[model samples]
Target: MPHTIRVLVAKPGLDGHDRGAKIIARALRDAGMEVIYTGLQQTPSMIVEAAIQEDVDVIGLSILSGAHLTLLPHVTRLLAQERAEDILVIAGGIIPPADAQLLKEQHGIAEVFTPGSPMSEIVRYIEEHVRSAKDLELPATA
Candidate 1:
């Protein structure tokens, strides 16, 4: 059987709000990808650990707490340290455009979606990029 696309939706760094994360999780699930939603207030280490343990294809981070620069990069760095950098990393929230670009350019984040981003676009991006990432896989990690 074909491997199912697995995604981990995470809230990092004291982000008490979770409606967006939950919605994305549901949407990924509805898209036929297995989604693991790590509830609110997760540390970067916790998020990376869960992604590793769950063996997800993608890590979707939702942060409304304005700590994306720190928390998001931390997760990617941890994943690299763990030899799991193949996992596609994406972010969403109230992130400013410049920070989003920095996250993708400097950090290892694959994409950053803002508040008004349509769910379909997010889903499509994951579907396309995860497949492409897998195609070039070094074999471990997401």
Candidate 2:
């Protein structure tokens, strides 16, 4: 059977705007991935714990409140501490190109989807990247 890609879509910090996250969650579910949305006002710890508990293959954080610097790194650190570094981490919202680079280089983020990005693009990215990682981790059968 094909493995199901589980994603934890979380809104960290004081970001009350969750429409984008909810939409993405719905799109991911429609695309055959399991999405667990943790709702608004979540802390980095909360996000990480939920990801671990859900055994998610990916995490998508929505941060429209400009707290990405603190929240994103905190989440990555927590995941690393919990030995869940294999989980792909992504973020969305008002992130600039520079911030995206910092997220990829410093926080170990796999992708950062900014405003005006299509849901299909995000879904495709998750599917492709997660499948590639899983393939690499599994040994070939004889």
Among the numbered candidates, top lDDT falls to 2
How do the residues 1-142 of candidate 1 rate in per-residue lDDT, one tens digit apiece? 4567889999999879999899889988877789999899999899999999999899999999988988999999999999999899999999999999999999999999998889889877987787776763322223
Q: Number of clashes in every candidate structure?
A: 0, 0
lDDT of 2 by residue, 1-142 (tens): 6688899999999989999899999988888778999999998899999999999999999999988988999999999999999999999999889989999998898899999999878987888898898873322222
CA deviation > 4 Å runs, candidate 2: 136-142
Please give the range of 10 consecutive residues that has the lowest summed lDDT in model 1: 133-142
The deviation in Å at residue 22 for candidate 1 is 0.5
lDDT of each: 0.88, 0.89
Which candidate's TM-score is highest? 2
Cand. 1 Cα-lDDT? 0.88
**Model 1 ranges with Cα > 4 A deviation:** 136-142
Clashing pairs in 2: none
